[model samples]
Target: MSKHLPLRDAVLSWLEYAGSLSPKSHSIVMLMLQPHWEDVVMAVAAVAPRDEHPDLYAKVKGDWMLDHRTLLVESGLAEAAQLIAQGVSVPVSDVADSFVTFCTGQARVPERWLLLNATFPQRTRIALGRHTLQTFTADELRQTVPAPALNGLHPWSLDLDLIAGAPFLHVPDPSRTVTRRPTWFDITGPRAEAQHWQALLPLMLWDNELLRVDSVFTVQHGRRFDLHPPAVPTTIRVYPGSQGREEEVEVRDTGEFHVRPIHLSALTAFCTAITKKIDAITAGLTHTRRVPKLRARRLERAGRHVVAAYQRTYDDYGIWEVEADELYLDYVIALEALLISPDDGKDEGIASRIRSRAAALFLTPTERERTEALVRRAYDARSRYVHGDKIKEQSEHEKLEELRALRLLTLQIILRWLVLTPADTGDLAPLLDAAAQGTGREQHIDRPLHAFFATTSPRSRPADIVLT
Candidate 1:
């Protein structure tokens, strides 16, 4: 068996590296460097800590300094020593081995390192961007690093795959009304086979997944990228009948789902796609700074005061149990839908009043045009009673035609808002022109718009085909 280095030396060198990376805001970045008893001895010798070394120092008490490297970095002296005595200390000499043992073992060391490595770059970005107006979000975290081994690091040591596969969950703070720290998780296997699970726990508790960036606001063809894990069957199916006969189908799928592993490169690509979309959406609008009359002056004023806080609630705390809480958002969507499809047979009181107010506040210019046209048609329908002129009967046919026309046009306008940004004016102009022409391009023009409303529709294909 190879002799182990002294624990002091190993701690010193590891501490030096970690100390170098610490920011002013934080204390020592104590990465618990673990090594076997024999290797620990060699490392301690290499580090050579000197401070009145006792003859019986073999059982040195709590965390001891190995100052050969100007700092100390080692596993918890008390716990690690106990672990080594138990013969479960992973026997390895390299950093990679240390990392793997940290991950696979029940010890907390692996989870800490995984978090440190993954978040170090993000913290660096935040520190740099702090001086600028730019902000960082999980969606904006798409840095392309060179292959790790090429940097002369451990081969097969660092699990960058775990970092890439992780899903970010951000929950909004209900009272503070801003996003809290995002939680990241990697559902890579049945039971989260590594310390990576601890790294993801915070975000999951906050229900971060439900606070997803609106796919609507992302790159036009992004959802089409479809970089999802394959469908793990919750139930399996079996055919019992002979070939060409009336077959009976039996389903037996009953396992926790797992998908083919997504590569780190693919994760990079996905983030890049979202970044591009955010870039497009905010591009021209930011430059032009043309705050449209999407809302009334008073409402706009109120929105300015409240929207930040409103957005914060979703951004920080998020809608917990989204399927259950999403109905809270339906008020806004239903209002928009009702603008196009008014309940003519039903009597309106407070509901219509509130809907009309929302329409004024939320409807864009094109949307307002379509909505006003619908209102005019409804007045003529007589099926809907409204204060109108005597010519309502004569305009009945025109009103009905206008109803469908405005509904379709309204849908397209909203879809455009969803799919393209004013910054993408160059790419989107042609599409808008095609839509405006309303000729043979109706289906094509309507595709993106229809797709948004038809997300649950089987006829729905990918967003890329409809948008691009």
Candidate 2:
């Protein structure tokens, strides 16, 4: 067996071997060595003070400079020796664990090694017309765009050096000759995971409208012995036009790939309509005095629930958790806030108020019948969910569809309230009495439920029975 060498000697030999490799290999080796260089240098400097170890420290320091492609200078070693001689303590580690980390390429730095090899197409653009009026400075733009965060930790941070100048969004691209369109935004993250994009969706749509997200194309380095990594492209595109649409295409090494298309346009349309209604609701809440202070406060709380439900619907959380049960509860609470009076104490009274409100608000008889049924079912579901009853035997897709219809109806109710109370607190009693007298058409009512509410009933249900 060969004789064992000291930590300084071992590191020096490794550096010499690393420097002997090709330029590309040498660059990777340098990246591998960069994070631990300071600690290794300090270890070498700690040994430099001893009379027996001065030559060994100088040799190790010289090898480090060679690995870094710096001139093998004696000045750095000399200064380190002087500092150590002057009683500046050089902190030394065991070097064993650090050496292991270096060899395994698991350094303490949150450096995204994969991103270093990524090829960004030239000229990415971000349109912020819906959110901001004036052009943004580079710093302001960075804050406006969503950054990738991993478990509350951002691996690659945004810096001025990473971005180019004003009037355009510029990023580092290896292909100097290519000029691409400016509609794309290049974002960096660890391995281009799906959750990061999923988390970004709700935030993109929360308060803004018409967010046209272009395809996110990632050209990864192929695992082959070539001078440069071949561009193996993967694309995830989100189209937030009418409804939301997500298209994904992934290419594997063996030329195998998969394509999945998710259509959420109807949902997007519903959410957009609800957002407009909420804006109206907010304005009405601020200006109208026909509503009592206490009732207005309750309506405000209900508005918060509606907004939360809307945001949560788009979030990455699964359809089961986000849709039917929880969103329905928000609808129920909001409707109750608007329709239920302070003195109404019993469930029967609350149900009567809901039915009466539905009759007044719904433009057509079919809408009234369907909405009344939805309210009754939703109230049952909400009670079951709240009281720990397992919602048994319903498929997730079916439940989501049911909840979607209820959510649309709930939004219509809220919109109707806003329309009626456009200037002052509008009375619901007249509308209710008209519906009761079978003369609802005579009332000069504003119609906001045309999108989802049907004029004629497809299937006959129980007629609207007013509870005494």
Candidate 3:
């Protein structure tokens, strides 16, 4: 029987003999093995100690030696050993140079390996083309890759909560078929919630018919997942009886479905405009004495509604003509609440009061009569809609144009009040009261109401409004 020399014995024999030759030879050998010394120690330690398996220890040791030898061969160190053996008087520098070249030639850690190890839910074995990369836990990945390289490799950590024990692959392997919905890493923080809302806003404003074929439209009011925060308590629902009549769908529910990429541009502008307007109102209120908290609260509530109305209006490009009118009427209602104080004796007087207050605060001297007439016409249309009168007297296109004009007028009025109101006297009620009492001076209106009326003909009026 041939006696097989174990790899550990061969390497140690060469090292001991070489070390005896000179200190330079010892240092060279140590330097060459320094990168993988811990691995070598681990391989040696894995074998059964002489005491535990005294009877079969030599055989166990031989097996471990063969395993370590295979590892060295795979690491490209076997060629370096072969070269060293061929040199009768190999210089230490030559041995070191050969080992360095071998190390450089060895396979590098792939990027996919880093990504999979860092993010894969569990220890999953993935086949990438012909090579199979073994699964690595997150901790193993951190240890395998250098700290700087790891940091550069994975800036965002995997959301374990999202993974939830799901199996994963480093890369899609052609041989294996796995069915699952691709998961997105859950983003946390206040900004993350805001971003999530912003992203969903476009989808929220998208027409249901557009997505009805592609996806199931579910209206969720509360927080459905930990990732989604409590969203605004608004929903886009079709009217119960409006079957196939997308037009019959309430404007408030569907008018805002006209959002496109261009409309997103208005979001920033609207935000800036509202911010500046609120700042102006705040500054004005700061100087006024005896600001009523009840009235201020009402004004703040009205301001929020106004901003919301603007967003709805800006998003109203694709709504049906009648729905557009309904949405514009809704906006007018909110604007009326902001500008006209509640009158106790006559609920019927609200429309008149809205026209009077809007004209005084927003219309120019020349536009006063025309603006009042437009307000009355709009208010009547809103009243009929609220009273369940389906407006069908006029052409639908004409009615839509009329409502668009009303929307423009309402926007102008609210924006003007936002700009003109003094911060000290935050409520529009006081200003309207002062104007009614004939004590306040008429202010110069910068943007004329007529500019908003340009799109609609003077002959056009809300068909639902019965002119008294």
- Give the higher-lDDT candidate: 1 or 2: 2
The TM-score-based order of candidates, best leading, equals 2, 3, 1
Q: Residue-wise lDDT of candidate 3 within 1-468, one digit each (tens)?
A: 012123244334443343333334333444345444444334334443335323212345345232333234322233334334444333434333332222222322222111110112244343323223243444443332211111222223222222232222232223221112111221222221121221222222222211110111111111001111111112355553555554332111222223334433443344344444444443434444444343344445554443333334333333444345566456675666566653333677767777787777643455556678888777777777878886547775576566656655664565456555554544556566566446553532323223322322122222222223
Residue-pair clashes per prediction, in order, are 28, 4, 7
TM-score of 1: 0.29
User: Which scores greater on lDDT, model 2 or model 3?
Assistant: 2
Least well predicted 10-residue stretch by lDDT in candidate 3: 215-224
Tens digits of per-residue lDDT for model 1, 1-468? 122323434433443343333233123223334323345444544433344332112433565543321121222232222223334432224333332222122311111111210121222221111011112333332211111111113232223332333322222112221111122233332221122221121111111121111110001010011111121112234455677565544322222111123322332333333334333443434344332222122122222222222222332223233221222232233233322222233455434443343233222455545454454443334222323333344343453344334323332322233344233223332334344444424453445445533432211132223332
Residue range 19-76, candidate 2, lDDT tens digits: 3444343343353453335554544444333353322232454452222211111112
The model with the greater TM-score, 2 or 3, is 2
Best by lDDT: 2
Candidate 2's clash total is 4
Pick the TM-score winner: 2
Q: Model 2: which ten-residue window has the lowest total lDDT?
A: 220-229
Q: What is the lDDT of candidate 1?
A: 0.28
